[model samples]
Target: MVALRGRVWDSGVMQNGALSELFGRMADVMEILAEDRFRVNTYRKVARIIADTPVDIGELLESGRLAEVPGIGKSSLAKIEQFVHTGRIEAHEALLRRIPAGLLELLRIPSMGPKSVKAVYEALGVTGMADLKAALESGAVAELPGFGRKKTDQLLKGIAFLEKATGRIRLDQAAEAAQIVGAFLAEIGQVKAIVPAGSLRRRCETIGDVDILVTVDEADVPRDEGRRTMDERRGAAGMGTGRMPVLRAGETLATHKGRTPSAQEAVIEAFTAAPFVDEVLASGPTKGSARIRTVEALVQVDVRVVAAGSFGAACQYFTGSKAHNVALRELAVKAGLKLNEYGLFDGEKPVAAAEEADIYKALGLDYIDPRLREDRGEIEAARNHTLPAPVSLKDIRGDLHMHTTASDGEDAIEEMAQAARRLGYRFICITDHSQSSAIANGLSARRLARQVKAIRTLNEKSRDLTILAGVELDILADGRLDFDDAVLADLDYVTASIHSGMAGDREKLTTRMLKAMDSRYVNCISHPTGRLINERGAMDLDMEQVVRHAARTHTALEVNANPWRLDLKDTHCRMAVEAGAMLAIGTDAHSAAGLTLMAYGVDTAARGWATKKDLLNGMTVRQLQVFVNKKR
Candidate 1:
């Protein structure tokens, strides 16, 4: 499918994400046109499959492993093959032609679905945001058959939110885009190294764009035997052996021999020419930039070709929080040195140009990790030689919250346990929703009792892992939990949350949360702020008070790992830990695949400078039991 912007790959190279996007875009367009519901759903499902597939589509196709995936029949296989070979889906192009391209933009509005967009289009001739805004302002949309005043107001609010939203995308989206673009660039035989720079390297929750620094193996015609060997391997593997025409060891590099592009130019060409790229923003001998299409978003990726000697310097300069860089430069100025993307120099005599640690050591400071380079007290700590080690995924001993088929989860309890065990987790808690959360197929008291027995029975049979019975009990607006304390007494863990009545004022919401924490059975709070990134704003709770109350009550606050809701966000995580409250990292996984989301939570915790001591996920099973038992 062709978007208004992005180039289709003519190189015949394809990634799973690109194929997923094509099918997803087709599904979206078909929905807008009110195409066959079954076909639309089928396309959407396949899109998800492609996006979630562990291997690249090209690799899968080459290995003939496509048939292993259920639901992909001959027609779907044909489309996948067609897109792989020709970079276009004929049916997708036909559907795009049937609708105004701007209609797709309308679907991006929060709460705006295809049906709503179709209604507005049919009734008020709304083709895009500008047209829709006019119709809403004139009360024409409110008067539509199904849209009343409330719906119109929501649409207007959504539009305002969309307008206010930053162009930056979530961290996962940027990372995925970087992987796809980086892979494409790596295909070039001359490309030697690719390192992600900027906010992406810093592990920020969102990224404005992707910046990558690269080094190409440059050599003269009597090419080094190693370079020749690599080229031979590339050719043997069916990848073309294309070499750049110039070579240099230091800063004075590129000397063009005829029209053949230099090594840097070749890399830039391949980068901007990738099929996943939507638009080429800029191209040069040393740098190239383009907006690339990933399954999740259209992300702009910039690539800079630098000498191997300057690669580290380039990384430090580009992988920056401007404030941190400014602080480092000030130190450089005071020390009679100069620092830039080229190198850290003492009066133009290169002092440190190689590794990041070398630059820090020359400046008389410890190397600050990219995650700690946010200019948030890390610089001072690094200088003082007191930087605390940040928490890592390996430190997580267990996932404290999850669900199973007894609730809304996709997998059975045993299956969920096996997935956690495979990750080397010592323990996991099955925190299914309480009865009040009817929409989630929440379990009743009797059901919970039965689940608790099933978990105990399972735990008895297992020696390597422990499964704890838990409930994500709802906190009513009036400050009572979905279940009484008597019901909670039967469970090994309890996480209280406000799922409904979140519209209450700050004082009211804060009071309800505090009251819930008062329960001895409550050991943690899940998705503490209830914020769905980009879609919903955080609930207005006085988090300062909540943190203090949690610390006092010994209730750990959760840093939910779900990308959409990294609730108890980085900032909140810092605040909570500073206030003496512990954090619990949980994928809040509904499916076995969801268990991997813990990486996002761990990164967020690290960004906040959390150590293993401040997170309950790092606690041993026995220690965790002691913790919850102490609450009782």
Candidate 2:
């Protein structure tokens, strides 16, 4: 009993992410050791289930709810209970002990699965990346069974891709790092404000490094006095908002550089000494760069201390797409002004130094959101006052896709509904998997009918929320949906998707996708491209044809909001919108915490120039019903 209490204390602090990773690593090690394939897949499945679960395992265990989840069998349950009580899975540790720890790193390379690694280890005695790379280059790996010229070539390419992608991190990972680091820096008394800049500010899908801009507290600095200061300074200088006297070509403007020399050192020192920081890359009076540790990876974060007057200018300059900044500077030059991080100026006189909007207005352009500063016709649109109003999180009235305990989800239908209601959603659809996905414990016809009845019962009781019974039906390899129209007609919404046979012929896959959309019962297609960022490339399919068919059928294409699978990416979203197809920003949330991922989907749509009207989720509950009903 004493050991149990001690174990529970340790387990309580282990977050879901850490637990997921632990199981995932265990599976990798098991595969490397040539463990039973069924056992390995079970471990992988449990890892996925845990990762999708937002709630703490200890809490679930305390409530005796963990055992209720499907896909977790007796043995798996034992392992989980062991983990919960002892904060360790001895089975996983035992598997890890059988192989060289470095062998796990080999799995990071694409196309290097456990079976392949096992073969290489046995044949070539390759246990690490360096040894494998040497073997591939020397053409020895090609001589191995099942690895010929073609596969070897792919492995070599994977190695090169891995090398190029090494230091870069995903946007979601960088955001988490920034949040933690920002919280850490906010503790410093000398710090006045913090703002994330660089590609992060622009919301790039992948970030090379993170840049943070801070305003140091100074004696003379005006806090939140940007507009007032701008008006006072411009009026006192006898300058009008209209065009200032044009400076001659090659004439430079003296910029008002705001650097509090007294406070810079203190802020920089505090930033470098942050707890999350792994190594101090560079430190100075105004700038400090460090590699900060995160649950995902070690990311380089550069913090810059700037004066209040130049804060807006610094934000505009550093939160840049290099091409967009270059184009903006060209426009500034044409207007007889000098633009830089310090501020926008006209021949030694500061014009718009305190506000980004003022800087754009002075340049005769509308304010461009940072997300649209990719030089992808946004500047031209701003000049013409024709930029589309991008979709916002508030515009999402409902979530059209999600799972429940009826399938492989960690939460119950009512649980998901309550969570969505808390997020101010007017409606939500319960989209458990159809009967084809045995692995997910997909509902049978009888089970689905019962769930439909249950949803209707819940809908009657839900005064402010509309609950739609839906099924994420599988599109079989032969281009037929897993459930017939008879089974699908009972549901309020249906999301069709390809879960297998993605490696088929391009023409066939395209045909399969088009056929799925033609069904009157199909309301949308989820993760149309079927991709997992950084892990799997998109399946081969004629997307143009898919989009065209979707538009003709009025089928909404989902912008699946899972960070790992932000499918129907920005470019694809734009293409689909241009083709006249609507988008559905579904969190594909397996758990309640997954519901918050709607923001990432919204961000992706905004980046694609999607307006609120372009999204199905952006519609009122009644409007959404009309849309899906029309398809039926």
Candidate 3:
């Protein structure tokens, strides 16, 4: 099947989440109908497993590994298989056939479950949310034996809370919220380390909620050990002094084989009452949940406190794309050890947990970066010690695509060069727009030539930077370059791109890009797919064919660093690398300020699993010149 840019892969994740919901519904229905308790519990447990798993169930079944997966037995397997093949599970269908679908939805209400749902349904015929609200208003639900006025009022509050929390936010929005919350908590001296977890940590495109893991150093909390009374000492050699002056109230959530009140508890308490927090779902010493309201959205943030010793284990556990962690746990099992958030255990002895690398090392695997923790063959790669050490933001030597005042860019060429030099870059390409890009103040052949001479003069004056004369040539609808070859040939680098004709016919689009890639004057293709995230959807092209053609030619592909246009995304980066094609990460900077966006491109490249070996910007100026000069 032809893979779609925003389809199957993302849809698979959603499918898994939906299955979790569906399975839980099945369990709730069976329980209410008074089905077998064992089967009900089995379904409930499996729902959690399915929900946590990163890979799609259908994909697992296709691989014939469904049977071997934990929490999936013959009965559950049949249900899943039936759902995959026929689009519906008979067991689920049977249960739905018996109960009003509305009652199952009622279980979604805060603190409401099978017993309460059954009671409400029987007493007031309140089968759905609307019915339940009506019953409450009529005083019918309040009259139920176990549910008093307070419970009814709370349920109303829960309904409103659930409604607000129902829809998910985009990954970018969640990221902003997490950063704000993290910065706020970092002020507290007790917080040793704080990092994002859940889908946000995994860098999933869309996030259900943001989970943050906080490690509290014991030294940060106050301890009162000096002169405990005899009776007080007798109560316990006791936990460490959990002196937290940060919050109004703090309590221990949980503790492992360590001593002292968990430092994690204080963090939980402070986080719950943090100024940004809008609601606290669950709060304890080890883990805290709250909704942090950013200017644009309310994002749920989970803070898990960990001791110093188990820091690595807990980080790995909570930073999970569950599918990735499940793979790691299986590896631990095979090695005759158990891995959990607390630490990896060899029977009664603790093995590795102090550091994330140590935990992976103990498993005989290389440390897998959190971004690559999607169980997409990363485990096998790690086992063989072949995991790609992706190119970091620091490794970038220069940018290849940028514009200046000659185009519609805000900065002058000299100013842009100064900005790049300040970034310690060895070189930069002034890729101003060509004649066809009138909207961007496209430079004519005369203007471009003047710009080139000015750059050459700047190069002579500059001690630390080399400026390359370049043009971002637009490929016309008919596969013709904006400027003739004579003009392109004069430039040090020629980067072709699609600004118009983005929605052209598929085959024509692929051909148009291929024709540009085939040009001797073109050193690279910019933002190969022409996607403007959250604005313009990616264009249609046979990416496989395009990537193959790029490899055949020596032309590199540009991973546009602009957050708005992170084209040649993580998958394409990997595709280019595996095909032995070089890649360039360019900020596509229009102004000096846009140069900082290089990190965003690097992040996208990391997600694609691209390493220095796969990128052109990782090269020194001389080395990069050799590759850029190839098409000529």
lDDT of 3 by residue, 1-632 (tens): 11232111112122454455568878888888888999899998888667545456778888999889888999888877765543345567678789986887687575688989988877778779889987887788888899989999878866765555537665556766676566555545466676677877766555787887766656644632211221232233222333222222532333322343345554565566554566888866577788875433467888777777887888789888889889889989999999999889999799988888899888888889888998878999998888888778788889998888788887788877878877788999999999999988999999999998998898888878889999999999999999888887788888899989787889999999999988888889999998755434688999888888999999889998876577888888878888877789999987775676687688778888888878888888888778867767
Q: RMSD to native for every prediction?
A: 6.1, 12.4, 20.9
List TM-scores for all candidates, in order: 0.87, 0.75, 0.66
Candidate 2 lDDT by residue in tens digits, 1-632: 01231111111112555456667877877877777888888888888787766567768878989889887788877777765543346677677679976677678776788889988998899988788999998999999988998898888867765666546677777876676566555545456667888988777777889998887655533432322333343354343332111122354334312422246655665556544466888876588889875545678999898888988899899999899999999999999999999999999999997778888998999999888898999989999999999998889899988999899887898888888888799999999998899988998989999999999999889898899999999999888999888999898999988998777889999999999999999999999988877655688988888888999999999998877778888888888989999999999988776787788888888888999999998888888889988887
Rank candidates, TM-score, best first.
1, 2, 3
Worst 10 residues of 2 by lDDT: 1-10
Clash count, candidate 3: 5
- The clash numbers for all candidates, in the given order, read 1, 0, 5
Residue 60 C-alpha lDDT in model 2: 86
Please give the TM-score that candidate 2 achieves against the real structure.
0.75
Task: Write model 1 residue lDDT over 563-629, tens digit each, in one string.
Answer: 7788889889889989999999989998775687788899899888899999999899888989999
State the weakest 10-residue window (summed lDDT) of model 1: 1-10
